[model samples]
Target chain A: MEVAHADDVELAHRIAAGDEAAAEEVVRSLGREMFGFARRMLSDSGAAEDAMQETLLAILKGASKFDGRVPLRAWGFGILRHKITDTLRKRGREAVIGDVDPERDAFNAKGAWKHMNFAPWREDEETLQVVRDCMETLPLRQREALELFAVEGKDGVEAAALLGVTPVNLRQILHRGRSAVRKCADAKLGSDED
Target chain B: MDDRIRARCDCFYQVLSDYIDGELSEEEAGLVREHLLLCPPCLVYLEQFRIVHQACGKVESDDLPADFDVVMQGVMTAWRKDRCGDPEPGS
Candidate 1:
């Protein structure tokens, strides 16, 4: 069953008060989503696993300090984001924003016609598989915004909240992410005009 | 709106993901909506955006492995036990 909206915050409060069951529930509720975010951010399964552990640890340790200004999930995601940044910094690598204009033009030129052609092939399972494969080609922030906004049902504001960016910035990332994925999907779907 | 604004209506098509998702403010949404009503290219872009949104919506969050939950449960359990010094598992 899906977790109720208030239960997440309630569980965080209880876990802060040393309730083991609540802590377990919090982990179970947010684990997969958090894992996916970490994996996408780190791009290394082992590092992602470590990041997940660190995120949970931070939640456990920092739960008492939560200001309750945002949803528990968002707050948890905030903690996870910090953990990711810290991990990356420790590894001597920082998040780099790719050149948006050139990348955009390249994908737009290649993808304009390709996506138009691939649109009709959507019913094919292979085409959807190709889309999924193409998703991995996007940069971390773009992929996160796309995954959260499109796949996980978070609105732009919520996604931006999770990523620590403004909603406008999140929208820009989503635009670029979709364009890149569409381009790659087009390439994978082949050039046959249909 | 001037010819420049009219010509750039297609540019807003790229941002329809934001608009349809309610990311735009009331004023901004009004501007885009007006453009879409007047521009065929923007309308086509909106349709494509909807299609992509629908296609993306079909991807299940169940893609995560079942074992992930089990592993997380174990990890949380261990963390709790460590915190509370519990001897019995899940007790």
Candidate 2:
């Protein structure tokens, strides 16, 4: 379960009471996370900026409704996710569905591994860049799942709710996302070595 | 790897990501532990997966845009007007 930061709840109350400092606090605390995720989801700098502005405005308008139940950060992210979706919709960019799984060929019909070699990668900035590049290649939903879970440090249930999927479904999405990046990184690194 | 080891590796691969996140049940995780004891390749895979996980976690967040303060100032000004029942500027 995502632990709701008590201070965030308190800050929401203060913001509800028209506290400018509290509002600033929320902005300062969550702005980077929102911007980063938005940048990844909406590659266009202008779209990303629009999404962030809308998100901040929405947070201000909706702060009074904060129930102190959901984590404020997660709630803010939910709003940002909606804004990103709307931005994408306006741009007529919908997520492409039903991409073939690249990992299926790695195993046989009997579900046994093939002769592919899994070498340990050098842990450095260069290899990390490879992994990040592979991550960028993921579908929007999959990359968002990976970012929410692996990057933003959100727990399974929180991430699932934010992604609007069941926990089991979220896990499947996450597994596919991880496998895609891992295999993609492997291929890139192998080519680099060659 | 023999057929038995090969079979274990296959099963372990299925739950490998879950195992890394400690999302597996105790029994499931224990099974993975036992498999790692017998399988060197699986262990290497696990190590590499951890590296990927770490790299993802270490990803830097994008910096705030330079005009963010100006944008935020407008938002706050509007918010203040709303709170004070003030009319829009130049209205």
In terms of lDDT, which candidate is strongest? 2
Query: Can you give the lDDT of residue B46 in candidate 2?
Result: 81
Q: Is the docking of candidate 2 incorrect, acceptable, medium or high quality?
A: acceptable
Best TM-score among the predictions, by candidate number: 2
**Please, what is the TM-score per model?**
0.67, 0.75
Per-residue lDDT over B17-82 for candidate 1, one digit per residue giving the tens place of the 0 to 100 score: 667777666766777777767766456546645544554555354356546766776567566666
Cα deviation of B21, candidate 1, in Å: 3.6
Model 1, range A1-194, lDDT digits (tens) per residue? 34445555676678788887777777877777778777656657667777777777778767777656677888888777778778776877565553373234322532231132224344566766666666656565676677677644656667787777897787777777676665566556656444
Least accurate 10 contiguous residues by lDDT in model 1 chain B? B1-10
lDDT per model vs. reference: 0.64, 0.74
Instruction: Give lDDT tens digits, candidate 2, residues B5-87.
Output: 33556667778778888877787777788878876767877887787777666538566678877766766766667777663
- Top-scoring candidate (DockQ): 2
Candidate 2, after superposition: displacement of residue A68 in Å? 7.7
